[model samples]
Target: MYSWHTQDYLNLAANIQKRNFGALLLHGAANSGRSELTNELIQFALCQSPQDLHACGQCSSCILWREDNHPDIVLLAADNSEERKTLQIKVEQVREVIDFASKSRHLSACKIIHLPDAEQLNISSANALLKVLEEPAPDCIFILQANNINKLLATIKSRCFKYQLTYPAWDDALKLVVENNPDNAEFWLRYFNGEPLFTPPFENHELTQLKATLLKPGIDAIFALSKDLDPKRVGMASLLDFMLKWLSDLFLVKHGNNANYFVSDTSAMQGLAAKINNDKLFALQEDLVFLSRWSEHPLNHKLQFENILFKYQQIYV
Candidate 1:
């Protein structure tokens, strides 16, 4: 368990021991350890001999969890397929969950249905799941996890007992990051918006090059960066995310506020923000936001990236 979430986990465990909750919705920012906390709670609930609100490793239920074949736990997640072209939790998957919930627990006291990304539930699936939530089956607990609860249906959100796992204190989070990456701890911590538990990408050479190009953007540098970054290799979504954060910082700096994500590049951002045309920058930001939605599409990524870079360059003119 993450040190920051220790208190929340204990409180939730105490609640679980007191009375059964039909549904629990754990919503929080990405990398806030919501999934880990949910898994720990499930293990604790299923353990025949829980030790101080934690699962006893020697118990049969704990052994099953370790083996990755917990009979009473069902995981529902988005369908990730190349052909599907979208991440969605289909109605068929929810139907399976309904069926699972109706059945008896094979090994544990109660059956658990874990939906790691509840926001991925499409309209049809959400409706199907709603029926089960409306009339929850006995000895069944539904654990739903989402990064954004706004994407969920109001009816669905209303049914579950919501628990929000907020970002940890800056010092506490920084300490965790420093332990694993002492050299670039502060840099990475700021990069992820202070999310401490994220695993840093193995190679950030391309990102470093991109940052350099952005810092001193010109026609030649922009064109070079567009060609140098291969969407397949570096991930177009990642590139867009980096650019979005940088642009956000630039906007903040333009409005007489400090940089939020790229604190290390505040001086550079302030310099650029002073020279940028506000209207052009605003248009570019909107265009990038629209393009981000299609970053994963099978379109020509190189051309798209080049176009975005060209637009970005225009903001300075």
Candidate 2:
């Protein structure tokens, strides 16, 4: 209700108003608007006087939300402010939600417990949350958000209403991205699959240049960007994903098939395909797949990523 995607908002609002569903799961690609929807739904559920599925900003509940002090709404999300070995929605966090559910609503009819990173809930924590879900708290609603629904446990997913919200078509999303950020339209469009907020910031010029370097890789493409490639500052996961796209495109073009990513870079892909063999391509793919799983926290991310680049260079040779 507060953002651009509203069709789901309307339907969800009505569902919330009609009766308590106890649990709901919003699944989609990374950077999809699942978090936004959960935020709106929190307000909608806690609002004393909602209008057509929107919160009344003037109500006490709405006022509390505006002040960032909603008692009935519990949001336990992954902590990303500081570097960690691995991030997760810890068991203690889910326990807090259970405790919150145990108490009466502070300002509304029911409690709204929202977990924005549902997939990050590991076994112990998920089981902790499941205990409450099985008991069925009185008038309590649980909201879960996941980037990939398949990663979630089937039993947990079955307890909640599942909604998949993937990104809109490129043309549709690019318009919004361009409207909000016009200066780096091309870079943003290509980088985020058209998801505006997911685009690397315009100020990250080094990464922008890295994109071009990957397209027309040279003998020292990795060394060229070594100074700016800080695993801490830049998202290594996304970098790996982008690299996979380029490699997959090159592989496809080599096999006389359509490219999966960077589809517009036909000539560049052709050049890359001509230089590399199928075996090398598959090797690169395996390396990327393995690195991506552990890229979140490598002992020496610099050396790890640099090695991938070196491997690519050797493949071309």
Candidate 3:
């Protein structure tokens, strides 16, 4: 846990001191520890041995939270991933939370609803929550966590206090990787797009080979590059994320701000960055970002990627 990143959350906690009807919306990119922080706050609220607002680990509430059985904490995720595929927090879930908020704490001092990935709440669900958020109960506090706040509606957004959780600097994230695997730090750092800390382990050789293909010149090389990764492997999505970031770094450098660019860290990447133009880079990034969101659908990912790559070839050729 990066204790430093929790400062914003701590401040939110402090601001809500004895204020029963407030909301905190925490937004962050993936792997930013939003859920973990919510859990910690839940513990603090329930902890019997709070040493001045901080949870004491040896306390009864801490023991309950540690055992994964906190009655006062209600959590709703997009999907069970273990079973159900409720793509968003449904209106029913919001209604339940509202009802629970109206009642009172059965055991814990405060009732907390930790809504992870809250942006996935559909239109009806957001409306349902808005009703309660506009007039929350005296003993209730809502904390909504999301990766992209733009996906949320303005009405819902206006009702709650907002906080954005930013990722640590690349150097700091890289340091953690170096601490565990001294030799593979740089390797994994590049593979994970400088986010080596939270990325899952996989075969580096595969992505390296794919990067080689993409870096080659000509339309055939571009097509080959897209096909080589197969887009079917479990690691393909991660590979595309890495590739997009690499291209983004180049895109930044091409626009004349190479001073702090990631690609500028290495001479070879910097050379590659020099060959690309900002216009192509911008269009490619937009296309990639669009495809990434749509990729979740039951579409032919290879065909989708090929179409995008073909545009690159048409322009770069």
Candidate 4:
């Protein structure tokens, strides 16, 4: 378990030991270690011999789980296929969960249904799952995970024992990052919004080039960068996320606040913020926000990206 999430793990473990919950919802920001905590809890719950509210690796249950052959655990997730472009958990999957929950455990005392992305459940699937939650089968535990509980149906959230794994303290997160990556630790920490576990070295060449262009923004550079943006390769959503963070930091610098995401580019941000028209910058930010909703759509990605870059360039005028 991550040091930052140790307390949350213990608290949830205590609850798990106290009594069996029909449904447990672990919600938090993306990459806040919710999945990790859920896995540990599943192991502990399924383990025939748990030591100190933790799974003992020597047990047959632990061995099966470690080998990814735990018959008692069912994972429900979005269909990630080339044909199925949408990121929704279909009702068919939920129906399977309902069927699985109705049966007895194959290897353990209880059965666990793990939905790692509960927020991806569409209306149909959510309603289907809600029925199962309402009348959960005996000895069946549903472990739901969501990045944003707000996106979930109110009824689903209400039925579960909710636990939030908040972003760790800045110092604790920074310490973990520094341990793994001594250099640029602070930059990565801010890049991932203080979630150190996901702050690996930023080695994506496309993003690297894009950042370099932003540091020295020019009409020619912006156009060149837009030309190289392949939606399938780097992803339009990823591009929008990077731009959102960059714009957020720029807005902060404009208002005399420190850079938030781009800590390493503070000097460049300050220089750009000083020259750009505040109103135009704010308008560009709004435009980005609007575009993010359609980033994953099969639109004219290159043209849209070029238009955004042109808008950013015009902010200097």
Q: Candidates' TM-scores? A: 0.94, 0.88, 0.79, 0.89
Cα RMSD (Å) per model? Answer: 1.8, 2.7, 3.8, 2.5
Against the reference, the lDDT scores of all candidates come to 0.83, 0.75, 0.67, 0.82
| Model 3 TM-score, all chains together | 0.79
Best-matching candidate per TM-score: 1
lDDT of 2 by residue, 1-317 (tens): 22446777787778888764788888764565666777878888899998867888889999998898988887878787858756778888887778888888677988888887888788888888888988768689888888778888778998998877656667766776777777766655765666655655425576566666776666576776654776666777876877787787777888888775456676667777788867877898998998888886656777777777777776775
lDDT of candidate 3 at residue 205, scale 0 to 100 = 65
The regions of model 1 sitting more than 4 angstroms off are 201-204
Give the per-residue lDDT of model 3 (tens digit) for 126-220. 88888888887766778888778888899988988887776767777777778866765776666555554554444556655555655554677
Model 2 C-alpha lDDT versus the unseen true structure: 0.75
The true-versus-predicted C-alpha distance at residue 307 of model 2, in Å, is 1.9
